[model samples]
Target chain A: MNEFLEQFLVEARELVEQATADLLALEREPDDRASLDGSFRAFHTLKGGAGIVDFAAMAHAMHAAEDVLSTVRKGDRPVTPDMIGECLTCLDQVVQWLDAIEDSGELPGEADAEADLLAARFAARAAASEGAKANSPVLGTAPSSATALAVLQEQIALLAVRGEGLEGRIASAGRLAANIFRHLGRFDDAERIAGSVSESLAGLDTTSIARSIESALERLADKLSPSQIAPVAVRPDPLSRTLRINAERVEALVSLTGELTVANNAIGHIAMLAQEGDNPLAAGIADEHRKLDRLIAGLQRAVLELRVLPMRGVFQRFSRLVREMSESLTKPVRLTIEGEDTHADKAIIEMLSDPLLHVVRNAMDHGVETCAERASAGKPAIATIHLRARREGEHVVVEVEDDGRGIDPNRIRKTVVERNLAAADAVAGMSDEALVDLIFMPGLSTATDVTDLSGRGVGMDAVRASVERLGGRVQLETRLGSGSTVRFLLPFSVMMTEVMTVEAGGQLFGIPLDAVVETVRIPREEIRSVGHAHAFVLRNRTIPLLGLGQTLGWAKVESDSDATVVVASTGGLLGGLEVDKLGSRMDVMLKPLEGILSGIPEIAGTTVLGDGGVLLVLDVKELLR
Target chain B: MALTILVVDDSKLARMAVAKVLGGLCPDWTRVEAANADEALAAMHEKTPDLAVLDFNMPGRDGLDVAAQIRGLRPSMPMAVISANHQKEIVDRAHALGAVFLSKPLTEPALRDFLAGAVRQIEAGAA
Candidate 1:
């Protein structure tokens, strides 16, 4: 099951308990920095881990507790009974969710309520203790006004505290303002403000005179980008346990692995050439080739292993969403994620996120029954949604399943006919399974009414189309009373793309392996022209064809007696691209279009060939769109 | 009825400007002006406002004297001390008395930020 979650729960339990004890100790001895730091680290760790596992409510509660302890650490607010109580409550809430996660691979249903209650309490305590002296704002990170704002605020509070050098500082502050205005060519206003400051120095009390100086200084600092204001370092370390690495670094590793594989192939080619020479070095070359080949293979595997991430990251994000959806709909729901340790390529895991989220959304919004309905149907009052992932040979299957009232096949049949999605006779001949599967059809939602969660009718079909675009397949399964499961079958890794090379418009282009249905050489005369586009019959259906040179904005040249067409499909749409010829299919590590070229969607990504030239991969989905 | 904010500064011009600002931006807020600690304390007892803003250095009994006395009277009253002397210990003392602080000649943005924060505290106290 979720072994990773099991480890997280065990460590989290200890951290939560440790934090609870530290908070109690801090209550007894408010100035105990050791205990304060202990609690801060514990909650911070707990919050980070909880976020990783998708225990949102727990993460949220820990976050608030962390904030409270931060104030204590900063010496801004002394440990109060209310703060201690709030911290303990926050700890208790996280522990409760941890227990639920341990027992079931899901958080408890009341998590949101607990988070809200604890957040409100923390906010109330923070509000009550208003000396909210945060780190003198990070001037370097903030706008120019931030430093001025901090200085202005500090000086305002300092007015009454001034004993010595009060007049000199005020005079200097006035002169600073006058100097600024003088440089800006507002000499009259400058003189007026400066004269007022010098005169007010004796006319008003110390507080009022200081106020006048503060106003003049504020006007000076307003336009001046003088980075003179100093900010105090008010942190106990926001990062301690974790080391964050850049994404570019990880991608560079992947790119190097690609080059390593290419170099390894060159060694094999040399070994073959040596064998033909019939020399003593031939045997050595062959032996070295075998050893190098194995080493390169292992190196490539290790590199790919770095990019493989378990499902926990994506699955953890869903629990909070389910909690939010349940709270929003006033429907109690539980989310269970299994096989969280089942690792997939990081890119593949991220690409699978949107489709899986939509499926989970649909499961909670429409698949689950209300408490009253569930009670009447002799089921648990709290609806359950199970998110399962497992490796099935070549593909990893992720399923979002919910046991509630399932889709009615008869309703689908009716909607199919009503929406003109299918002919009346065609729908009449469909079986229950086939009819239920029609929910995957675009613009054919079975929900009686639209709600915030679902029933937009664009939900399931979009999931299907995206999954298909990622070279994966989405399937729907249901029984009338047994609920439904939306399953997405994805590849093990998306780091390396298997693309079929095609020569188009005298330049080379790469078509993703999944997008290519077949490359057929059709007779030139058989290509019929229809509305400025060529077409040809495939089976009984007419498929539209376009010249690759024309599509790429190159001048169209007259074709030969025969044409080589690349059959491409994106979701349900089918099309043909007539190219000069097809080349050898190769595996490539694609770096998606970045920088200025990133927004241009037609070119999906680029990859390096053995000779180091870049090959552009075509995104058929955007191409058709 | 409009909420009230007491503003105590020794200078008449300073107090009048604050009153004008209260009337302009926060029209509903009634400004209870005071020239010193005694007047501020007297104004507070007569009709306590939702918030208190006092100048730190006043004649006779200073602003901190007024805050200390007010804390003794209404321990949890939302109070602020405006000063130009940014001595760490002095600001710390004001903070120790459970009073927030502001710089002199409060600008519009700073005033707005402080009010938003203080209002939350007031609402939380009420809750």
Candidate 2:
């Protein structure tokens, strides 16, 4: 039961995210059946998950939304901007409930009341949509009598306009009056009305007949109901739409696969030992072990693939925040998302959410100017903020760029000095790049005045912290007049990484393969030293080399005539770490350093090599800095 | 052998909820779980459950469709459709299929009632 609750919470949050995204997407293409189905499915899943956990109030609230979505799916109601807003509100309520549940393992005291209020609102909206129902529209409990009377009124109007088609028009009008009277249980009145119309027809008097029909129509109008009864479209798509599984299960699968890969590597080592003896049976075992290694590697890859998820959910959320922020700031800003289909580890994407949101919000609030200000600056009234994510080798680079007033480095420098963030003389000598980096320093804001939109002092500092937590770094680029772009380069997955094992000082250290450009042998004869920093020329570019043994606090080892350098780069900072040996490359699932070593700058994580040796994966960027 | 019950819902949580009630009411009963209609039908194929609890609003096939399939083969099987939908149409359909329509959240009282109904049906079937 506990496991189920845990799983439910995970699935519920995902569905809420999905539903919110689909509703916002529907704002773009209201006629999109796919989004409609997607929304309905999400609500359905949310309600179902809630039900399983016996969270009746939450389930009931989602049911109301699901019903509204059902009506939209069946075309009984048109998808309006208001409806989308309502759906988003409903999702917001779900988010609140999920948060409360996560905190207390149960709902808040007012959950039922809140659920009822939201359900009532959704139901009221559903009823309003029914008012605009296409067929058999009724004014209010307005009986079939009202419909007949409406028809009679139309017929009489036609006759009055044509002035000559009175015979057919009067005959149809008389028939409607009779049926309405009969429906009202007034048989005598029906006959009397019919007789009066016929008598007027005999006198060939159109005016008299039309007058009687009008009086009868008035009587029927009093009984009208204020709604229409329209048939819902039958969407009989009986197929398995989607399946939600516990993410923990997938995580477990990945862990097992990692273990198998290590085990397989050990098997290879054993097989090599057997083949060294040159016995026929041992060689056969070695050949079979080779085939097993390939299979295990494939299985490992397949398992890890389960953790990859598209960035659509995370990216879609920004548009909503952008919309709300722009309206509140009265800034006419537009957001464009590119490469939303790019995929990354679910954990990486999760950690990226708030940081991404902060960047986007900061872009709209600070980077983009108001219409009046933009117009004066000769820029378009509506500013554009573009968010793009694309795979770059083993990393996913997400950039939020805006066409607003760029961050002024001069102001940042001034603020740095005024706020005493740094010594005045030191800040004055700082480069523009270094000054810009000061914005991310917590407790400081470059904004001159505090506004609700931003300027809360918690600026890029939080974003940088989050990105760094995910084994990623933040890059900021700004021009004085043009705009500012904040880019985050993160690994494809934070859970597992491929590292190149290198031996230094008789200890093994792993370097993320993505950060290593190449390994080269630079002769010591060409090495130069400037103020205790080692430098060497490699392919026309001067690269600095730091021996791993020297960096890790071991006795400084002097390089021989030819030295091995593992060239590494992070966030554009490059350096070479000379190690004694470069070992075999393998995949290792990482656990963040804990206990006393949690915040160690040099050690990113620790992993066990196949031979039971613990290897510390070096934080290449940190080491270079 | 203990009577087997198949619980189908898109939510693992909801499936667990029903399993809890079933476990409480019929301690000896076996409970099989499926996350969607396809798995539900697949479970039915393996071994017909004496009782089936389904949730509506799945992606592909919903509760009603799954119920209809079961109605064809196990016409006397006592089933309950647990959904968040409170529409009259859903209740009517459940009645037509001789199944009980239970609103979602599937709270303690609701599940207890469902169990009672299932237990009665199970005894009648055995007789």
Candidate 3:
């Protein structure tokens, strides 16, 4: 699931609750915009959320409910008790759909009935309104729809205006005929439009035009029966239509071939190295070694790239979600999606969606606000959520930022202490930003009760765990009452590893580059002691330093004032690690720990370097804890 | 005329990749690489290429800065931005600065399309 969907789950659940409440309230007083807006938001958000999870059935159902509410919102049709009942029932069905989705990752079969009924109600109301308004459109608020329809009607008229023979007329009339054909349930006409639209939009924004076509198809679905609605081949797996074979895979395969060539050369070199002859094998060994080195280097490059996938795959789903949430919450939000082409590995991308969702939801539910509240604060009622991705050095950083209520670090401190999750003294000394991070701790929630949207203690921890398992870090930044942003620093891919070879205890241990911050030579004079614990002054701050020998229960070396230190940090905690020597960075594939060795909390994974030597990758986060 | 192109990116590797792709496609065209927009601007002041390919996100004065400056300095100079950040604001700004916008991880297809478009625009302007 993407960030929008996860956030939508929380928002949808909340929307369902709100929708139910709004429905009950509307039963008594139907004109309240708050209730109507709330109900609309719930359905709209539910539709968007369902779309993200690929729960098309639920999305379709919610779309129907949204259409009805949207029409009512425009006052094109009055919000009758029957409409309210049906809308509320739709909400219940959506809730049930969400439940089913959660249970099975799919909406129930035969679920489209409710959506069809609701859509029929909307279409019937629209027809009745059309009958009543012979002079003007009854839905008088939005001119956009009217303008578009006028365009359609004009095109239909022009087809009659221009009879035949002129090639221009044939093309223009063809388009109009196709538009009328698609909307008027003429399969042949719709196909013509599809063909022309595909051709015309060839050099234009293909995605947007396709999306518009998709919307047109959706709107047409209400008028036609199920069989007629799916006119033309529905283009089986339309997703695959746009999907290109991931270039990273091709790049990786190329690099692997390069590596295999090097490995073969290395085998020849090893054979020559074994038969150490003064004049016989030395030249052959040198030549083979050079080839082996070249091939290995090429292989490493390919493997690293295999982890790099375009960021677009992870960023695409949020747009529909933001659209839904903005409408439902009655907070106009435009998603500013950036870095769609920023690639990261598939595993990291998959792991990323959950955390991003939680953060975005947190921003929407608790961070952003009602229109009235926003107006009072002199902020736009329609908030802006920036979903951005970038490659910062070796890490893929994803940020979900909203222009709503910034998180109150003070509130976090209070929540932490009140919940008894941490000591008051610890939180008191901690910066407000650090206090905010307490949200990621297990069983830590500031919300009093589990609302549909927030106060569910599952979000931050799940995000943190998922990101960490993918060899990444998550950070939360918020301004007091302004808005908040949660960023995940993820590896390019989960499969490839970047390890820094370090000498510790006379053995070469490969520490994952993700864990190592910087290798610095700690001078003897700068090292001090805070009682029995060793400390070092870095940038005028006393940071606790640990020797790998002592931290990992290995025997300590004899006194040496100057120590080679690996400065490392994870999820925020920073410390210096003493090691013998810093080695070169190498790409290695991680092999999982087995048996009792797996129980070692400080070891992340083990990998084999090009030299066919096994090196243990340390888990810096575990050591910091 | 074979178009002379300049590629600007903060990352040497990324710059090399674009150069490699361009070199493979239009080997006759002269391609120069710059690390930052400022350097690119300075390089252009010396000898402006037929077109400049810029990276949008950079440490100092980004692609937008280079684009706006280039547009101001030489109105007819064709420029294209290969951006990791495909924000609408950036795209709008690029268009406003008379620069063509291309999203990053610049594959052969995207680059080919962009180059073709740039060549046409430049040729049209010249005409």
Candidate 4:
């Protein structure tokens, strides 16, 4: 691929994004002049770009859409939803073309047929609008033809200026006349004028060329009716101060930084070993280790910052999705986005799209009420779904809130019992919040009938699982009659995690330190059997206990002494794990389990320890569940 | 002597396209590029070029607007106003400003003819 094509791909994608944003904005506010003109210019410039690359099919398609927008700009037609839809459809095709070009390093071979269909759609919409204005004087020809004739007359007048560059000026006038004729679809006249201009240019005779253009204008004036010419509006181009870098390169840098931090930790381990031996250089080695640790910490932070991206890109996509969903379901729902500028790690943002899509879809499908239902319930006819994001402490919290019928705790309780997920007596004794949380249980769905958008029994649990895999948590709050909001609390970055290593089944495993409340030594006799489970009293509160060796299916060693226990909290529930021993704490970069091991929910990921051993990190939430 | 030609377009791709063609046609001539009218005018003020190729549709001020200003400074400089949009208003304005109107995507044949005419005019004026 040439440099021009590469640049074109990048720029064309940006233009498509900008144009889609503008069209969506126009859909909300039809009379917004800035958005209308912005959409027009984006399309105009996009068409020009296609022309530059000799992509005639794309240029032709864009020209059709641009003409419709030009009519709206001229006040001949109002900005209708149908018009916006057609233009958006055109942009979608452009996006597909851009992707194809990027993949193949050239224009797609099959674009012509797609472009034709898109152009036909725009042309049909334009013709329908033109039919409505049948009474107008300019019937067959567009108003631009009149402007072309006026320009032809202007070119003739310009011939009167006999000056230093007269020869070039005359050649330019001839080319302009021929082009205008061609633009009006008068091919024969365009050719004749072009031929005559070439002849006149060879002789340097201004009078003959002027006569030829005047005669052509006279003939054209009879066919083109006069129309008002609108002045072209000017808008300032936005300047970009940021540079575009390849995403893979950034990922590679992040991986290298992770390895460097691990190497630095190894140095710290060596320094500790030196101190243990009482070596003469122990103090100096420890001091140097501390300095390396601080510098690596800064480098880690700077590298992580490169991957931070604003949530706007992810949030903006929901607008179009919600719009299409609203139309398809025949429901009037408006998606209001807030705090889109909140930043998150790029990996988190990329993984967020699917989960967010499911959440928003569920909110609209099951949470928001229909217009009729809302009207009878004394609520507004149009329901609103708020997609919000914000930074809260060490986490970025993304929330999807709806203003409609909230999730009924009774329905969830019934579904839990029907699905046999929990005992009926236990569910009955649970609070409304606890009952609602049961919606995250797999195979439990309150909706009686499944819809295409959601309610296939694989939603909230998957959402929770995905969030947990990213070292995050999901929370749901519902107000029975009002609405529901699902909040995802995600870490600001996912690379580095502080973990406390524990000896379980004679092997070392790392448990995320954030979940560890405290470590204790408790007599084995204090653990009371609670029907297939075990519980122990800690500070007057009964906490469930699990033997790590037994849970991991390892050979248990018979011991009568006090058991070493690590108390941890996951999903707001406290639990104690009996391990063989508890080790020191260290920050390690986690790599998610891939291939066959990925199916195990209890193990979140693995990290390389300083001694080059793999430390398996436990997912406390998944384990407790 | 090699001459300097000013190329102005808001779209970097369009500017590059023209530069690519011009590079092939006139390798000895120096090409100066500007992204918008401000930069184009600034370049003109810094050093008047022997020729200019301007895009008709740009942000802030279109190409013809810049051409008119350039005409005020150097009336006899050969210029071509290029645009994908072939509206009569732009063509007439280009003609009124004594500029050759070239439609885009600018073809080699069309640009080559304009450059040939420009070189002849420049050499004639020098003589």
lDDT of the candidates, in the order given:
0.71, 0.75, 0.66, 0.81
Per-residue alpha-carbon lDDT of candidate 4 for residues A200-268, written as tens digits (9 for 90 to 100): 788887887788787777666554422111211111122232455666788899989999988987888
Name the docking class for model 2: acceptable
Query: Positional deviation of A226 in candidate 1, in angstroms?
Result: 63
What TM-score does the first chain of candidate 2 have? 0.61
Per residue, candidate 2 scores C-alpha lDDT tens digits across A505-539 of 88889999878999988788888897889888888
Give the Å shift of residue A602 in candidate 4. 4.1
lDDT tens digits, residue span A215-265, model 1: 655554442322122111111111122332445687798788878867765
Ranking by TM-score: 4, 2, 3, 1
Which has the higher lDDT value, candidate number 2 or candidate number 4?
A: 4
- Model 4 scores what on Cα lDDT? 0.81
Question: Which candidate, 1 or 3, would have the higher TM-score against the true structure?
Answer: 3
Indicate which candidate wins on TM-score.
4
How would you encode candidate 3's per-residue C-alpha lDDT over B24-114 as one tens digit per residue? 8898998878888778988887767888898876655878898888888888887888664366988998888888888765678888887
Instruction: Score candidate 2 by lDDT.
Output: 0.75
Question: What ordering of candidates by DockQ runs from best to worst?
Answer: 2, 4, 3, 1
Clashing residue pairs in candidate 4 are none
What does the lDDT read for residue A413 in candidate 4? Answer: 87
lDDT of 3 at A266: 45
| Candidate 3 segments whose C-alpha is farther than 4 A from its true place | A1-343, A390-397, A420-450, A520-532, A560-562, B1-127
